[model samples]
Target: MIKKTIAFKLTSGFVVIVLIAMLTIGLFFIQMFRQYTFNSKEQVLLERARSISELISENQQSSGQMQRYGGLMKALGTLAEAKVWLTDDKGNPAVISGMGMGRGMGLGNTFSSEPLPAEAQKVITNVLSGQESISRNFSSVYNEATLTVGVPIRESDQKVIGAVLLHAPVTGITETLDKATNMLAISLLAALMLATGLGIFYSLLFTRPLKAMNRTAIEMTRGNYATRTGIKSEDELGQLGSSLDQLASKLGFTIDQLFQEKGKISDIIASISEGIVAFDLELVPLSVNGALSEIMNQPQLYSNEALKKDFEDLGIYGLLEGIIKDKKSLQIFKDWKGKKLKFTLSPIIDNQNEVTGSVALVQDISESERLEQLRRDFVANVSHEFRTPLTVIKGSLEALMDGTIDQAQDVERYHQRMLSETKSLERLVGDLLELSRLQSGKISIHKEEIHLPSLLSDVIKSLQTLADKKEIEIVYQGLSDAPALIADYDRLRQLFVIFLDNAVKYSPSSTVITVEATLIKGNTFEVKIQDQGYGIPGEELPYVWDRFYKSDKSRQSKGTGLGLAIAKHLVQLHKGQVSLTSELGKGTAVMVHLPWILGN
Candidate 1:
């Protein structure tokens, strides 16, 4: 800004000085010429007066002497365009004539400006007294300027008889001077105009490059170092442009390095399955990545919002507003898109220890939360599963130690209780083994055709007693002659039985627990188990197929939490899919798909 101001000042000053100098020189010459014109006019009048005096003397002693003299005076006055007057020594007029001849043609007629100023009058009077011609200039009543010359009419003895004075209005001579001055003014004005134009043109040439350099500097602040003043002049402006280009080049490289570093850090962060959010002091988004956008369930949430106005339109503006007002940040536990995320918001502080803005780190803790809950559930399930068996085994072993039973019939009760405990332990171990096998590819399923409708009916019959006790009705519908699926029959059975048993266990007495088997499009079989029971909540649907996850409301039941997990795993092992759709208090429809190859 300062440089621009200075440049403008210099340009204006240069123009002003050139104009002033030219105008001064112009006026100086014009005035000088005006004076020179007056002097030239004086010399011409004196020479004309001298010629008239000699003409009058040469024509003396003629018959028309006075007439000849009058004609000579009248002609001279006509040629000079002046009023001429002749007088005797005592100031009486002798011969008088003037231009514009005719009406006032007498010696008494005064058509002239006589009576000059003291200085010019004294010079004319002195010459006339010496019987010689003299010239002088003065102001006139005919517009304040008149030139006059007086010549004496002398005898042979050199005695003055009369004086001949040639008088003319100096305005005609002033006109020539005026014309010269006007010409000079025009020249001076032209010079000034040309100088101003040149100054403007050169200033533009100089300023254009500087403006581009300024733009480049401004762009650098926006992290755009690639901006340049693309000019190549031979002047100082060119040198400045070259310097600016060099600066831009160095800064561009630095910016590129910074970007690469930032990008590397960003890539590392985005590669994680967690979301990271950064904001500026204005509580607006500064940076966000793929994970954050995914977490937010919107691709546009993290894009291009760099001010508080951004949040105003978001409706969740209160969150940022509250944080800024409180000068604090906190981790918010959220369930986003059926996924658990631990969001930690931390304030970014300057060196002054003042919080400017906040940054959020979002972690997809769906798996972590699942694992934590798994650990808790495992501890509970293991304790419950072992407690019943351990109680029976303890009672039987105490009785045996006390010698309560000796014969086969008496000792058999203790042996059966020990066997039951041992079998329960075996079931627990077997479930673990199954899960490990599914995860590690240790157990490969042998695929075969299985009648799902028939198999499911048999399992229902076996669990009919348990369903009856819970007042749950097992209703098998849509069990048409569906195409038998080519899958691991044992694994399919496990998947079906788990869902069916859960439906029956949770339903009220006489409430229908529907078992549906039908052939879907494209040779696919959908086995749906729906229960008019207390349904799993929406929040638990994602976790239902996960390991060791049991709904809070269902924890009263005596069963391993691994049942659903194992079932889901087993179904997946057959290249099938299992999904649960339910709303709170509404019946759940657990759909398991078994694909059938076209030939099969």
Candidate 2:
């Protein structure tokens, strides 16, 4: 089936909403009407109950027959299809009356249908016992609901001998409710049908120009300034047509100039390799060239913010403020990720002295900063790395010269101390060598598939003695016998061993160590070595992979701090990634994602 258009659907929806509202209101009205009707019936029965009480009071037999009055039963039964009984206290009904012949009518010795409700019996018993009056509304088992009214007939001694009850039927009101419901259902359906037809007719009348304007507007949006609606009605449609024609006439010349200027500016921007971003008077980003985005190394910057927000945070959000307040052109340039930027701010005044927003140009100076940092980090790491061993060597040499090693034991201790310093110096040199080889691709690779279960078992066994000495628990977990990617077996062993060794050294003697591996998505298996050791701080996480970088927490301990740095490089060589997550005192989890395959 073809779907209805928006205008037609709107009309149908409006009518539906109104119809539903009317039906809801009608239901409430019907409920109130029933309440009023039932209440009127209850009052009529109560009057009959009182009248029968008075009539019996006026003519009570000495044997307490409660002889039927002239019209007492007739008046009570005339209200609706109901049965009134003057029953004795034993429930043996007597002096009964009814009106309007009904189907399956059975009221002589007892009611043919179910017994009376508990509430109606209670009302009747209370009236008889207290020689008072009572009335109640309840659903009778005979048919629909009713109001049962009771009154006691008292003797001359003012004592009740028997009771008179009036049951007023209320089925007629419920019947009326069914009728209104049917009427409402039919009326609502009719309203829906009428609304649907009117909607189709009106939709065509209302949307004729809107459809025409849409076509014309689309063409104009595509830079076809000659496109016009050519409609000239006397209403707002005519006004719109005139406006569009005038816009098309003047916009032709304006658009030509705009194209010429825009083309020239685009050429100039594409000519250079620098990134440039321009903003309008309201600090909205008007233009961004390719060069500046290239400097950020991320393309989502444009996708992230609308044109108005990009310039809002220029120069870390202060450049615009500075220019606007000072009323003078301001310039700021900084290097980020080795890219240099030249930001300029000038006023786009309309013959009035007012300052507009700024423009920024970013150029790549990565090669210059790259060389500069290489020199700086080289000097820094080398100076710090050499100082510790050199200090120990100077201390041991000075002690020997002071006659502290005159005896054989002292002389041998002095020599051993010096030898230890030389070894410490050698380890630093070896790290420097390994790092150089890894970076320059000078290290040869022995690429082969390796099983992780055996490798991890060997690492744990190698550390068994250390674990026993420290009273630590070691755990290795993984069930899959997955084969790993091309890598040197020895290098991979060293990588895992560093983690275990570190956990053994830094963690409390009784802490647990865990090694786990599992296959992830896309042929990638992750191996995580976890430890409950002293955790690295959040601030130091960003620089954990840099050379010679150490957390202040672990700085006073031994071992080449280059352990993590070396691990990072080796993982990168296999075209894999290593990530470290830690929270202070909680512990650390180092994850390694490597491509692997089932040995099959």
Candidate 3:
């Protein structure tokens, strides 16, 4: 197999074209030169033939003396080396030259008295009709390649009376044409050889830069971006090379920028808390980041291949299908791994306003959902708490106005009931105000070192009456001279009172509500409140610190629902940590760790 380069192919094509052109022009010139030689011979014969016919027509007054031109014809034929004949207007040959008749080379064997042959007759007829005729191929009457010409003879009155026919062999013309053809062949060969050499040189000149550009293209395919075709010619090829260089440069820069932007987008997708994914219309995953994997509960799915499978497994395909069909965005919330995740599916629209794909954005909204629910519950609880007190006060006032209790004892009972309800309403309002200030960071604390033993003793003593009302014991267990803790004294007292009151209210009669304070790890003090009561379920324990939350709402306790919430917020405001652990059908424990800061 021959390997063909651009130079080889171009040169080969140019040579073939040159050969064809030279052959055509050479054929044309050779034919023209041959015809030119034949025509020159025919002209001389025709001129001598005309002179002989004119002499005969002048010498004789009629056809009776037509033989007088035979001598003249012989002389003219000898000089022109051709056969001459004289024919009357009726195409009858009357005289023939002795030059070729005796040699058996005339129009026929009967010479002067014979009829002209068909082809020569046509020439004679044309000549008699006042026209000249010449033919290059008149071989039938001659033994050699020949030219034949016929000219008319006119009388003194300008009327045609006879015709002269000339028949000449073209052998000398053939010899001359052969010599001229050989010379043309030699010139054509030399021209072809020169053209071939020039074709090769010019083909290389044109293809050299193209070859360089081709090599540069190969280099670019192999990732060598800096290669360039340094051709500087002002031709079209040079302009093409310049365009290619600019294209390569632009492509390299654009590709680098795309890689950088891709990295940045990947990092952003990975770092964000939301799960982000993009897919084409075919449901094939275009991109799937780590967050999306985590959201799908398939954290191992980090590649597009696995993510596509995950999408089907997680039923996200249906969501995407819906989004595409509707050409609109959709949002849904689901519980995933104990988190409330809100997923938004939006259609990816192209410039033509067609939905080409979709993107999913998943966010963890459990905290927000819980807060929103808590706000609703707080509003309802506030309304309920207010209604209870107001209802009792309105009943008592209506009883007094209708004179339904006119006796002194009945009147006093109604008055006391109204006053009790008003006090409860005032307590609820006060608790709400205090809780709001503590949670909103509007309340400030004045910190001082307070002995834990003394603080606990005072709290137990203050809540002992309430504990007794339920027949529950408030037991304190701690060192009498334990280390002091840095905290607001009044807030700390209030915190303990809320805890002790709750313990006493929730515990069974005759059960123990134990309070213990101890120093855990130096510079940190802990307080534990434990009670033997119907404990909260594990599922509801997480929300027990939320405002207006109650584990046993069925119990008709008179205290407001803000105790534990207020306690938790007040603890946090003092830079303390609070946690509670409980088990159903068992007991509950609350632990508070406050930093032990020494102060004035």
How much does each candidate deviate from the true structure in C-alpha RMSD?
A: 13.9, 35.8, 5.7
lDDT (Cα, tens digit) per residue for candidate 3, span 8-38? 7877788778878877887888788777877
Sorted on TM-score, best first, the list reads 3, 1, 2
Local distance difference test values of all predictions, in order: 0.72, 0.70, 0.80
Residue 306, candidate 2: C-alpha displacement in angstroms: 9.3
Off by over 4 Å in 2: 1-275, 279-286, 289-359, 362-378, 597-600
Q: Report the Cα lDDT for residue 449, model 2.
A: 79
Q: Across residues 527-567, which tens digit of lDDT does each residue of candidate 2 receive?
A: 88888988888978976776776665435666767778788
Backbone collision tally, model 3: 0
Order the numbered candidates by lDDT, best leading.
Answer: 3, 1, 2
Error of 1 at 338 (Å): 15
Which window of ten consecutive residues has the lowest lDDT sum in model 1? 99-108
